[model samples]
Target: MFRVEEPINKAADRMLKTVQLGIFNSIIVNRLWTPLQQIKFFIPTGHGTLLGTWRRLAVCWFAVCGFIHGIIEGWFSLYYDIIPGDQSFLSQLWKEYSKGDSRYVIADNFTVCMETVTAWLWGPFSFWAVFAFLTNKPYRFVLQLIISLGQLYGAVLYFFTEHRDGYAHSEFGHPVYFWFYFVFMNVLWIVIPLVLILMLGDSY
Candidate 1:
């Protein structure tokens, strides 16, 4: 009985590994990218090129982060609802997050238009930016700098607008979420993009 069970377990383990490897190849190879190519994207060709180690890494970070963010805010929230007229869980989640945001609750015409435009614009730009950087395309950092500046501008305007509404709010939600996720997230977008802009300028 013990010997028979041992063979069954070994067979099951092999089957599971095969399924996992297949899933990995399908996701990475067919859609996202090849592992070898992704790895190659990380290595610097030289110091002066735009595809240098540090610049590529920074652009990669911006592109990937924007890609994930774009899907939620740009596609699900704005585009999906506009096209097929479907309001999804993703859009609802954005509203849930917006309860903590003045732009949603403040009832101002200006914030309404601004927020709507940004959401629609960011989704496509984010995807394009990621693809551009990964393919070693030019102007990646330049676009990133523009996006970062927009992010910083929006964050500042929203914060001041929230304050003026007599909310006296500094955090996005609770203290921990507010500081790390909300405040720090916005700050780094400003800082990193500016740094990359300077680096690129020097490179040219």
Candidate 2:
């Protein structure tokens, strides 16, 4: 169940902002697919032969990262002030995700600034990295290195800040909420970026 500290109508004016946004209840009728199944959709048909499986997967990872940073985190950067009480699909998604990190529900300052930078900066860079790789740009590895380093830095700060707070933002040990939502989800940013960085090092 999605819960928050604020009243449902606390941001009545902001509710108007999401009138056109569809409700998640009606939009998400089916169960989510596994990551591997979803990745198939991101593989570029023209580039598939050139990319091979691992390279295609890496590109798909950047595509996913771009979507999350541009669309999902971008929404947070815009409407975070109204999230706890907002009823839009994205708002509801944030509320659900907040179960693992209550800082989102409350719109913590650090989270807001971090996500804003990520949305504006890394978001577009991620897409550019995809394009660079697909077209075989001379600077693809440089872009990859910058983005991976930035993601690594941001992710480390995210975890470190939460750790300093004694993990008060989450349930800490709840199997799904803590382990899957908080740790596992954020850890991907750390692990994948680190691997990409190492790959860049090998290429040099």
Candidate 3:
């Protein structure tokens, strides 16, 4: 079972009062299906596509990214002010993820702005990239390059800002919170995007 700690920043006390977070178990439940279920739903199961395996996986990645940015992060951008107190599934999900980075619960300025940009810009573009790839659009690689670059840049800023703050937001070395949630999860944005950028360069 996972437990939420008090906000690390004293300035967050006022905001924390409005939050009614509960003890989160490793398995988070909501009215909707789990994230894995959602991902499975998005992933193409057929091997009939003209695209190769790696290309199909890339398309799946963008589809997942679109869902996350458009739906999940979009909710955060819209309702972050009330998320701590809100018990909606998406809100609960964010609350759960806040265990890894409390800036989300406190609605830190950088987080809010960054998520807003991600939701509005990259969200739609992700879906567009998926569509372009599936349809074999001439500009598919262009979209991939742009989206991958944005993701990489944003991810760099995300980590660098946390480092600059001396990693005060969450427990630095905790297994689930620090290593899995904070580092491993966010690092996908960095590593995968870097790979896609390199692949694009190779294609040129």
Q: Write one digit per residue (lDDT tens) for candidate 3, span 1-204.
A: 233564557436523532433223222223122433343334443344345656766777787788878998999999999999998888987887787899999999999999999999999999999888766677989999999999999999999999999999977887766886789879999999999888886652
**Among all candidates shown, the one with the greatest lDDT:** 3
Point out where model 2 deviates above 4 Å.
1-49
* Candidate 1 residue-wise lDDT, 1-204, digit = tens: 123445877767644644654464346333433332354535443343435456446545555445545554454334432332335654544443343443443335655555555566654666666666666566765676676666667657755666686654333354433554345545665666566667666753
Question: C-alpha displacement of 179 in model 1, angstroms?
Answer: 2.8
Give all candidates' CA lDDT scores: 0.52, 0.77, 0.78
What overall lDDT, based on C-alpha atoms, would model 3 receive against the true structure? 0.78
TM-score of each: 0.56, 0.76, 0.76
Summarize candidate 2's per-residue lDDT along 1-204 as a digit string, tens digits. 323555768545334333322243223222222343454445444444435555556666777778789989999999999998899988887887787899998989999999999998999999998788667677888899899999999999999999999999998887656886789879989999999888775652
**Candidate 2 C-alpha error for residue 189, in Å:** 0.4
Q: Which residue pairs clash within candidate 3? A: none
Q: Which ten residues in a row have the lowest lDDT in candidate 3?
A: 23-32
